[model samples]
Target: MSPAPWDSEPRAQGPTGPCGLQFRPRMDMAKLEEARLFIQSMDYRRTTWQDDDGDTILHIYTAKGQREYAFAAAERLQELGRLDSKEHKGKTALLVAVTANQPEIVQDLLSLGADISMCDIKGQTALHLAATYGFPEVMQVRGRERMPLSTCLTPLHCAVISHGATMKAPTSVQGRHTWLVSLCQLVLSLISQEIKSNKTALHLAVKDGNIQLVHFFLKQPLPDMQAFINMKAHGHTALHMAAGLHTSLHQEDIIRLLLTRGADPSVRNLENDQPAHLLQSGEQGEKVRRGRGTSLVGECS
Candidate 1:
């Protein structure tokens, strides 16, 4: 049998510094082809080689964007009982593919029975990485499975946190509005999943000044709205958080949305401060109060 890829010796070179310059010996194509043929013949022993970092050939190929090669290697490796082998950092080939945003490779690995729930040392799963990187298509594939309740965060939290300011306002077109509403529904579904934090996704949305997301929550059925809308943790509602952001451009709109949807403006936080008290003392506060009428805060109180 040909020498394994790892067994190829490095050629010695002249010392470049305290350490000698050791040049890596290139693999002879003839020998590599021989190994490939051996692997094709189901020689599991030779094909299961791992590097010093514990990355199998499948990991290397998948991370290098060698899609076809990675697929074939994955098949062989899976059969040989090494498909999900992890590297030094506890990253599997599937995690690497997701982080690299290689959807095709990710799909191939999933078909090969890669564990979608596997997380890295940092507790980030493939779904977490996909959401954090804004790869919604990849997220759709991995998200079909019921995800474990993420200890610190869910994909919904990651998606909202990673959301950029570039999202344009929906036009008056009915189709676009419908599509946006559907997308928001998906987000809400994600948000409804259990998380470890006391603060809900709406709290994060309000803190981020995500008016669109806040508006979506307001539009849900009253029962669902009551479930999440006025949710209080740390003694603050979404309204309190929005009201506290004196610099938010969308503050008035968000506050109005919350109040109209049954948010209690009179609710006090841990600091014993009401939402109206959190509002800025100036024309801005008067402007918001004026737009909604004097009864806005009074009626809620």
Candidate 2:
């Protein structure tokens, strides 16, 4: 009975951000009722934000963190079965949830049929947003398999670059853990199955020194360390990752795992350098160089 979000009339902006949060600005509740009625009329199809940017009203809410209004609107959309609809950016409601680091919201969207693998114009996916924010929406996983949040970068690599570690799932289950964990686990499983650029999640795990994630990833049945641990992206391996971490329990463990799993300890990067060459070296250029190398493949090898 509901027309697709794409079939709906043009809207001014895409709604995004957190849902159900209290607001200080007193918007017309009557207007909200009207919006709700509009939602029902549209069969929960997302209102389009036909800007040049192509972002939807959903994108606006998630990016800006509008809590309650966004949540209410999102719920209406889910009920109408349009939660996965994308705007001009090729982003889904799941992507917005990942961007906002709202695990519960992410679960809600996924349950309502959001696709986890769609890439945006920027080649980003829900995982990229989660990893970029260091929000491990994954520790909730059970199996080794995972899926891509996007095409340009796996969630693991995204986690490595921004957080200097692995993407983890939230350990706590809370109220929405089942869906969150299932979604996170599915992503993980898909990631494990596909070895992009000849790298597995294990390779990525070691490269970024994500001890929890790395250790957790190895527990999966896929045991091809040499295929990945020894492999190089931009001339760096997980061992190179081991030397240049901020030092945490899991961080140290990832290094140990890589070494134990046969990550070449002596690999170097395009600059003929190793991660050790850049550790804690407060020289201005050193930080920049390290950042550059790490950004390429999740390490300063």
Candidate 3:
């Protein structure tokens, strides 16, 4: 007959059951009442009543941002040894909460003993999703709860790799750059952690020609800042990457920052080529070489 009132909201669309029943969305009072009654009548023992995608009642509520129902269902699920249950996509309710941007539901699920360590089929944890999706509030919640930052890629790496134009908005609106800088400040120790190819966040930023990112990493008050700026990926330092990048408008700026911040120009790569040797010819390259030579001479004397 007619579509449900909550169906108009994109976030309200959830997995359809065999009966074609969809979960109610937040702010739909009448449908919420119906869902509340349905949840109350649901037999906690019969926990396998999921939709085609293997999402249980808990998954639906969390996905729809039904805070109170989701919280109660989470508590019941926790007691029944199902608080961390996964759907067909390997996403637990906690993961769904983060994806839904329901930070309040996220906090509640975590408090109800949801497994913070749970990852999706892609092996991305809740923290990774939060960072990749630019949900600083979710990240802040994890930080406030003192959640360990120990994922393989780490949240810092995810933020850097996923940052793009959409995240470049003004700082007042939580731009990606501002969000990444805040994360760096919060987890300075994790900044140096590398991913595949031994590429640290600095390496990725430099490779992406992100001058602002390079500047932020270099400016951190790490104990051994030189070692950080010079971290290698496939035997190439960030300085080497910067030197090799000739097309980016920020290329010279990146190279200059790396040199001034103790990047060892004399350091050789796998082929024994120093950053200066990788530099292209002409005015810009000459400026970089001059700065590199000066830094080297200063280091030597």
Q: How big is the positional error of residue 32 in model 2, measured in Å on the Cα after superposition?
A: 8.8
For candidate 2, which ten residues in a row score worst on lDDT?
A: 12-21
TM-score of 1: 0.72
Q: Where in model 3 is the C-alpha error above 4 Å?
A: 1-37, 44-47, 144-151, 165-178, 185-191, 281-301
Per-residue lDDT tens digits for candidate 3, residues 132-179, read 877766666676554455556877888888775435533343345566
Clashing pairs in 3: 167-176
RMSD of each: 10.3, 10.8, 6.8
lDDT top scorer = 3
**Alpha-carbon error at 5 in model 3, in Å?**
13
Residue by residue across 1-301, what tens digits does model 2's lDDT show? 3333533433223333223322233334554565456555642123533345555555555555443345556766555555566776677766766665555555544554566676666887666666555554422411242454446456555544553422243333242323323443445542432235545455565554556556554455545645556656556655555555654434444555655655654567677876556454454324433442222234443
Q: Taking the candidates one at a time, how many backbone clashes does each contain?
A: 0, 33, 1
List the candidate numbers ranked by lDDT, top first.
3, 1, 2
- Per-residue alpha-carbon lDDT of candidate 1 for residues 150-204, written as tens digits (9 for 90 to 100): 4477666665666542143222334333433433444446235334545666788
- Listed in order, each prediction's TM-score against the native is 0.72, 0.47, 0.78
**Model 2 ranges with Cα > 4 A deviation:** 1-35, 38-52, 64-68, 71-85, 137-152, 165-301
